[model samples]
Target: MAKSNILARTGNEAMAEAMRQVNPDVVAAYPITPATEIVQIFASFVADGLVDTEFVPVESEHSAMSACIGAASAGGRVMTGTSSQGLALMAEMLYIAAGLRLPIVLSDVNRALSSPINIHCDHSDTMMVRDSGWIQIFSENAQEAYDNMVQAVKIAEAVKLPVVVTTDGFIISHGMERIEILDDAEVKKFIGDYKPEHYLLNFEKPITVGALDLTDYYFEHKRQEIEAMKASTPVIIAVGSEFGKKTGRSYGLFEKYKMEDAEAVMIAMGSTAGTAKVKIDELRAKGLKAGLLKPRVFRPFPKEEIADALKGAKAVAVMDRSDSMNAQEGPLCLEVKAALYDKAANKPVLNYVYGLGGREIKPEDIGTVFDDLFEASKGKEKPGVSYLGVRE
Candidate 1:
């Protein structure tokens, strides 16, 4: 398989390719930093007829998401994006997009949620909406950002769920990287076409959507949503394999690195995890048993796979990109603890909250965090949820 130069582009540009490849019927969004490039490139495609899609210029991010909800409910393959406060603005409608099963794919260029405001990246933006019933796929680089967007559309449309192709805001979104974007004929053949299970705009078989489900059935519908999420785990893997076969780009929900004999491991999701792997390699060279567990599918949580992956570890460290305010544990950390709590002979889990508010997370900083976690494992002192790249 020859890897051709598919144009070296930023994360935002790659996302445009995704929107183009998915060929959504409607692309609705307002510009926000980090995520704005997605719609910018996509809008150009609409104007040039590169994509046969409706481009809606809205007043605000809220309207952008609302438009998506409306378009998706109307059975259109809808795409949109937002970052930081922009995503927060779209919070309410996001849940509506999912409960109503609209299958919209939005790029959430991960930026810090503000108050002492900043324009950088963090998971707080996405973690704030964790329970909104969206399947979140975090990308390690521009390539994953692009590839995942294509897969996200397929996966979201398949499970009748909304998907967010997330990456660190300025980190991955702004940084330039060389990536091989998959061609249309290849992606089209593999991803197939978008066919809605319950389209609101189908004139031939018009039916009620978003009808208020009474207490009697609301819980049941939500329960079904839970089942649908569980179903996505296998479906994403199967579909991802199919994508790899088509484009020579294979992927997993959680990227496992050197875990075969790892005694003490680290787990993280999204862009920072990529840097963590570099640190793990350095530790391995020093004869330390360090490894990384980078979760690709964040929403479903991938419990079974995660438990099995960390099976042999003596200590596990979870690196969280976002911090939950006043919560006893971070969302991902809480979930990891829950996953291993039931098992016997399990190792202690450590969590370090790093890279908040778009703070720079250098490869060595990641290494230092792991060294602290590893020190805790060896009784070198410091342990438990240390916040990295933060000034005391």
Candidate 2:
């Protein structure tokens, strides 16, 4: 095992520390609420000569991502940070980066999108880009955020896909926690060196990139991208396993908490999972077989694995921090239901859209979800979308 240090740091601080350890070649970012501190701290590292990163402070988030794309195309290990509107501004460039197969790692501090202009914890930002072809990882706390940031670089470079590591804005991003940080040397050794198979900087075998492809090869290229995502599942598992061996902190697509003999389960992502775990323990102590499944990786869906994990559960409750506004279930709930279709045909699955605009979700509130799940299992409560913690 590697020698590690326990430090009290916020999620943003942990992520910035991880970036300083990784020491990427280029970082182009725009400051945004909650997420600003990540790149802000990284920039200080660059200024103080702590790392040899070329920090580009752009005028807008779109320009920041554009610069990252340019730097990455030139075969540089690149990264950046953004949240909410910043992510929304970079939407166009995000697709381009993924389509071109640039391995740029991004840190996304999850915050609600603007309408009423709230700057707080929510999944609306990341959920908006769920299908943008980037691998998404959600951190439960500062420790996971730091761990995930290190792993994301390896994962992105291995699969040649952009990755987004998200921490709940203010909840994890601002909340301080004790994080076990690996030695800088260990992180460098684990991530290894970036040696791209092909890049624009290669003079001997120069190739065209971003050429307009209307119909001839667009579909085929898209198919290749699809296959890459499918291929990434095993790579994710392998990397997680290796990270575990190095530091004894293993990770997977989702975490199953007390699911051994669970009759009622709550599936969630990000910081809500932390809250759900407490309620699960309380329910278990009350002699109820309640459990929690927290998804760390949201992209690639992990449908089969998720289905397998929820196989024994009689009732399942999915908590979504962002609503899809489809008048049905939230994004996470919709996907969870789809995953359970064939395997748990008769299982009752409920959808609870909670914590929008950073509304507080407490352990007692989670207890209510389990209570509803138990009732659903008994065929008393009908499963549907419930606005949890919302005044209805």
Candidate 3:
């Protein structure tokens, strides 16, 4: 493995460093709270000649994505960053970017969607675009955020699909932590050059993009996208393996912590997994067979693998940072329930919604969850859909 430099930086700054190393052809972005710093830092890199990237400052997030789509289609490597409302604003272009099979890397700072207008860490933004056909990877901390951003370029280009690398808004994005960064030469070699098979700039071969296909061809095109999304699983694993070899940091679809012989388990994603790990350790010392499963990739869902992991547990709880507003459970819970639905093991699955609008999730809150899971395991009581760390 190559020697890495350790630096103390926020998740947003780490992602910007990865961007500078990748040094794409174009970066089109608008400022949004939490996520604004990522592109802002990258823009400075462009200005200082640290990176040879064309930074396009657009008026709106929609325009930012639109410009990215245009640049990407023209055979340029493209990237951008945005948060909650900004992501919602770019929803339309998100589909377009994926439909066009443009390999644009997006850094999404996960924040709660607003009705009351607040800024903080949550999964509402990324969850809203779950089915937009983009490959999504959630980071547990600043290091993972940086690593994922670098790997996203390879994954996106390989699959001819856009990739969303998400970090918790204020939690990971604004919080500084010590992270190991790959050398610039190593990153450049790892990402390689973005050479498209077909691009608008290739005048030698004329091709049209985003042509209107009403019914006859639209379905087939979408099917191709589905296949590509499915095919991304192996590609993700391959890229992760290569990255691990270089950096000695291995990544999988999901990480299982102390799940072996565990009777009770909790599933979650992003930075909350860090807290959950701490809680799991505390519970383990108390002789409680508690464990945690953190899903790194959310888009492909990893149904079979997740089902296999939870099959042995007597009771399971899924933590969702965003409320689905479905009158029942959140998005992560729904996916977990669906994944385990066919499993013959009669594990009782529970849902807990927490950390919305920058709400703090303490270790005691997580301990309470394990207590409830232990109770549910003993068949004493059933903990159904519940809220964690919320004022009732």
Candidate 4:
């Protein structure tokens, strides 16, 4: 019930607006397709003096993340944006950022990685860095993109880890939608201020960063990082709950749509979940118990919670926009299967890799997934990976 501004904004514009409101101390970014406008619009804010920020126009995404690391080490709240190749180039620095425990926030427009030179919506880029140790949050549309960006700041700072907020390229990035934006004052009040316990700026507490850790103590540091990630789930949930109380939109690890009493369930992320919801409704109208499970947080995967949600379903299908290419299941599917291995092992779980390279996934396509789930439940179809919307 917070005071808000109703506006039609593309996902890129919404992310940029959220950045303007947060007004981090530093933003070193390189422009890339779909994600370019996020930093592009923020740059204009810098030029117009709307926010007091040091906008560094870096030569490449690698340098952008490098610069962000330096700024963050100096106790400055930092953020940036990138896409497919941009994210790939920044991959090396990404590991360093998270290992060093820098609270840097990144906006990643989810685009397919290139080998054949494609620029379109897909989760490949984000999934590529799944183990890089950053908290990953996916947005379903423009509104979630905006809200996630705002909440990401708090999550990163609270956990002292880097965070990546992603939106499917062009799908959500270019699509405009009516969004309820919270007032700037509310956003400002909600985030509060950044106060680092140890930073380069603190002369009295000077400490070495990015120091080479050899076999002597590297293991302990890595273990601590692992524990931190394990501990971040609560931080993520708490911040999401607080943001909801302030903005009237609550978020969680994932969304379970019509899961109660559902015999067939399809799990997905990003904009695909929106389409799946429609299909679930239609199936319900036809007297089919279909449902959808949409994961908002990919990293620090909510294994137990996901297992619990799918426990009641007779059949579950996990839809992934990117394939693992390991001749097994897609990334999201693999996670879902692993989650159900012990808890819901008896249930039939299917994997569907769809919409790669921005191929459209219609409501009918979602219905097809549900159909497969039902068929698998009845032991008519084996549970495994199936490429959807592809010429097999």
User: In order, what lDDT does every prediction score?
Assistant: 0.84, 0.93, 0.94, 0.93
Residue 382 lDDT in candidate 4: 69
lDDT, candidate 2, 1-392, per-residue tens: 89999999999999999999999999999999999999999999999999999999999999999999999999999999999999999999999999999999999999999898999989999999999999999999999999999999999999999999999999999999999999999999999999998888999889787999888999999998999899889999999999999889999999999998999999999999998888887788889999989999999789999999998888989999998888889999889888888664668888898999999999999989888999988888675878899996
Residue runs of model 4 more than 4 Å from their true location after superposition: none
Prediction 4 TM-score vs. true = 0.98
The lDDT, on a scale of 0 to 1, for candidate 1 is 0.84
Error of 2 at 214 (Å): 1.3
Taking the tens digit of each residue's C-alpha lDDT, what string does model 3 give over 67-134? 99999999999999999999999999999999999999999999989987988988999999999999
Q: What is the lDDT of candidate 2?
A: 0.93
Off by over 4 Å in 2: none
**lDDT at position 347, candidate 3:** 74
Q: For this target, which candidate reaches the highest lDDT against the unseen true structure?
A: 3
TM-score for each of the candidates? 0.96, 0.99, 0.99, 0.98
Runs off by more than 4 Å, candidate 1 = 1-5, 379-381
Error of 4 at 176 (Å): 0.5
